[model samples]
Target: MKLNKVTLAVGILLATAGGAAQAQAQPVQNIVLVHGAFVGGAGWRPVYDQLTHDGYNVTLVQEPLTSFSQDVAATRRVIEQQNGPVILVGHSYGGAIISEAGNDSKVTGLVYIAAHALDNGETEASNGKKYPNSAHPFIKSGDGYLTIAPEYYHSDFAADLPAAQADFEAHAQMPTNAAVFTANIPHPAWKSKPSWYMVAKADKIISPDLERMYARRARSHMVEIAGASHSVYQSHPDDVAKLIEQAAQNAQP
Candidate 1:
C-alpha cells in the first residue's frame, strides 16, 4: 500500500512539473512596441498591423523624445497596461528605452531592430562612437534638439524604403532632445531578460557591427537582413514580426 502511495505522489509531481513548463512555453499574447528617435510610434504601423492580424495584443508607445527618463516612462506606462506577459520591441534609439523600461515584471522578452542596447553608465552616443556610422554627417541640431538633415535623410536613414515614403519620413521627422543621446542607462533590463536582435546590414545610421555587438553581449537570438537600411522595421515588417513572434513563443519569464 505504501509503495502505491509513493508511486502516486511521484506521478503527481511529474505532472505538476510538466504543467509548469507548458505554461512557460506558451506564446506571450501581449506586445509593446517602442519607436526610436527621429520618429514616433506611427512608424511602427506595419509591424503593429502584422502582429494584430495574427491576433496578438499590440500597443505602441510614442515617446515624447524629451528626455531619457520620459521615454522610459512612456514605455513603462504601455507595458503596465498589458493584460499578460509582454514582448517589448524597440527600434533604433527605442532600444535604449526598452533596455531601461523592460525591467517591469510584465516584460518577458525584448526585441531590438537596428537599435541601441546600452549597458548601465553607457549613453547611446558613447556607445555609437565606438562603431561610428555614416549618419553622423547628416545630424542637425538646434535649440537643444537634434534631427537628420532632410536632404540626406533618405540616404542616411532609410535607403531601402521607397523614395516617396522616405521623403515623407524625412519631412515628418520628430526631433529628439540632444540630451536624450547622452543620457545614461542606470539599469539595463537586457542583462536579465531574454532578447532577440535584428541587424540591418546596409544600415547607415547605427553600424551593423554595433548591432552585432549588442546582440552578442545579450546572448540574444540574432538575425541579419542583408541590404537592409536603418528603417528595416518599416521596410521589412514581415521579418521583424517573425522574430518578435519567435520571442513570444520561446522566451521564458
Candidate 2:
C-alpha cells in the first residue's frame, strides 16, 4: 500500500511539472512603449530591440501630438492588438497618455521614465506650474500647440547627445497641441496598478524634484540615475530595459 501511495505522489509531481512547463512555453508578457511629444515611435527602436531580444513582446505607439484624445486613442489601439497583459511604459508626455491607457484591463503594470504621472483632475500645465526651473525656453504656446523652439533642443531636451544627433532630433520634433497639455486626465491607471519610476537627475526640461514628487504621489519604486538628461532612455537604454523587465516580472501572476 505504501509503494502504491509513493507511485501516486510521483505521478502527480510529473503532471504538475508538465503544467508548469506548458505555462512557461506560453508568451510570458507583453510590453507597449509610448514616446513623449516631439518624438516619433522611431525613438524607441533601441529599447524595443533590447526588450524583444530579452523575450518580451513589444510595441511602440506613435502618438499624434494634435490632441490628448488622439494620443490616447492611438495607445488604446495598440493595447487592443496585444495578446496578453502589457507593461505599459511612457516617457515625457507619453506618461500622461499611459496614465489614462493603463486603466485598460490588459495593462498589468506601468513604468514612467522621467515622465509625468499625473493624477485625476491634473493637467500637464498644472503640474509644470509647481516646478521653478523651466529649462527649455523654446517651448512656446501659440496656434493651439505647444512647441519647443528648435534652438533649445540641444541644451534643454538632448543635452547628453552629440550635437549632430540632437540636431536631427530637433528637426524631427512634432509639436503637441496646447490643448493636450492643459487637458486634465480623467482616470489615472497608476492608482490601481503597480508602478515604477526612473528619475533623471540631470534632466533640464523637467525638474528632477518634480519627478520625485510624481514618483512619491504614485508610491512607485523610484530609481535615480545621475548625469542623465530628459532623454534618459536614449542615454541609458539598458537601465530602462531592465526596469521594464522588473516591472513585467512583478506583474506576473
Candidate 3:
C-alpha cells in the first residue's frame, strides 16, 4: 500500500508539470491597445474592429496623458484584467508607455506602430531630438500642454488621410502635458520581451529613420509601410491590423 501511495504521488507531480508546460505553449489571444498623444483611444477603432472580427479579445486603454507614470499605470490595469497572456500594442507616444508597462508578467509580446521604443534613461523628448521630424514647427505650447497647429495638422500628421478627416482630427486633437515627454523610462520591456514594429515611411511627426533604429535596438520584427503617415494606424487600418495579427500569431505564451 505504501508503494502504491508513492506511485500515485509521482504521477500527480508529472501531471502538474505537464499542465504548466501546456499553459506556456498556448498561443497568445488577449490584446491591449494603447494610443499615442495628441489623440485619444478613438483612433484605435479601426484596428480594434478588425481584430475583434478576427476572433481576438482586444481592449483599448484610454490614457489621460496627464503624466507618464499615470499612463503606465492605466495600461498595467488593463493588462492585469486580461484573462490570459497578452500582446500589447502601442502607437506613437503610446510606445513609450508600453515599453515601461510591458514588463508585466502576463504580457507575451509588444507591438509598436510608428511609435517610440525608448531605452533606459531616455525620455521621449530626448529620443526625438535624435532624429527630428517635420512636425516640430507645428507644435504650439499653452500653459503646460502641447498641440499641433490646426492648419498644418493635415499635412504634418495625416497627409495620407482625407483632408476632411484630417481637419476633424485636428479640431478634436487631445492636448498632452508637455512634461510627459521628459519622463525617463526606468525599465523598457523590449529588453526582455519580443517586439514587432511598423514604420510609416512618410511620417512627418516621428522620423522613419528613428523608427528603424528603435526596431533594430529591440531586435524586433520590422515592417515598413510606404507613404504611410504618422496616423498610419488610422489611415491604413488593414496593414496595421495585419502586422498586429502577425504578432499575435507569433507571440509566445
Candidate 4:
C-alpha cells in the first residue's frame, strides 16, 4: 500500500509538470498599454480599440504622470489584473515605465513605440547628451510639470497628424514631472524579457537616431516607419498593433 501511495504521488507530480508546460506553450493574450507623458489615456484610443477588437485581453494604465514610482505602481496594478502571461506596450515615456514594471513575473514581453528604452544608469538626461535634438526648445516647463509649447506643438511634435487634431492634442496635454526623465531605472525588463520596437523616423520630440540606438541596445525587433512623427501611435495605429501582436506571438512561456 505504501508503494502504491508513492506511485500515485509521482503521477501527480508528472501531471503538475505537464500542466506547467502546457501553460508555457500558450501564447500571450493579456496586453497592458501604457501611455506616455503629455498625452492622456485618450491618446491610446486608436491602438486600444484595435487590440480589443482582435480579442486580446487589454488593459490601459492611466499613469498619474506625477512621478516615476507612481507610474510604475499604476502599471503593476494593471499587470496584476491578468491571470496569464502579459505583453506590456509603452509609448514614448511610457517606455520607461514598462522597462521598470515589465520586470513582473507575468509579463512575457515588451513593446516600445517611439520611446526611451534606457538601460541601467542611463536616463533620458544622459541620453540627451548622447543623442541631442533641438527638440527641447519646443517643450515648456512649469511648476515641476512639462508640456510641449502650444505654438510649436503641431509642427514640432505631431507633424504627420492633422493640424486640428494636433492642436486639440496639445490643448489636452497632461503635464508630467520634469524630473521623471532623470529617474534611474532599478531594473529594465527589456534586458531580460523579449522586446520589440517601432521607430518613427520623422520623430522630432525624441531623436530618431536615439530610437534606433535604444532599439539596437535592447536587441529589440526593430521596425522603422518612414515619415512617422513622434505621435506615431496615433498616426499609425495599425503598425503599432501589428508589432505588439508580434511580441505576443513570439513571447516564450
lDDT of 4 by residue, 1-253 (tens): 9999999999999999999988777768899999998888787889888888988888899999999999999999999999989999999999999999999999989999999998888998789788886564635465778888877889878899999999998898898888888989878999999999999999988899999999999999999999999999999999999999899888976
RMSD of each: 1.8, 2.5, 3.9, 4.4
**TM-score list, all predictions:** 0.93, 0.90, 0.89, 0.89
Q: For candidate 3, lDDT tens digit of each residue in 1-253?
A: 9999999999999999999988767667899999999899998999999999999999999999989999999999999899988999999999999999999999989999999999888877887788888885646466788899999999999999899999999999889988888888878999999999999999999999999999999999999999999999998999998999888888887
Task: Give the clashing residue pairs of candidate 2, or none.
Answer: 138-149, 145-178
Residue 57 Cα positional deviation in candidate 3, in Å, after optimal superposition: 0.6
lDDT of each: 0.91, 0.87, 0.91, 0.90
Question: Model 1: per-residue lDDT, tens digit, 13-117?
Answer: 999999998887889999999999889888889999999999899999988999999999988888888888999999999999999899999999999999999
User: What stretches of model 1 exceed 4 Å from their correct place?
Assistant: 1-13, 136-141
User: Who is ahead in lDDT, 1 or 4?
Assistant: 1
lDDT of 2 at 184: 79
Which whole-number lDDT from 0 to 100 does residue 130 have in model 3?
84
Which ranges of candidate 4 are over 4 A from the true structure? 1-25, 136-142
Clashes by residue pair, model 4: none
The residue-by-residue lDDT of candidate 2 on 1-253, one tens digit each, is: 9999999999999999999977755543799999998888887887889999998999989888888898999999999999878899999889999999899999988999999999878777777878844575546565766667788888888888889999999888887787887777767988888899999999987889999999999999999988998988898889999999889887653
| Residue-pair clashes, model 3 | 0
lDDT of 3 at 143: 70
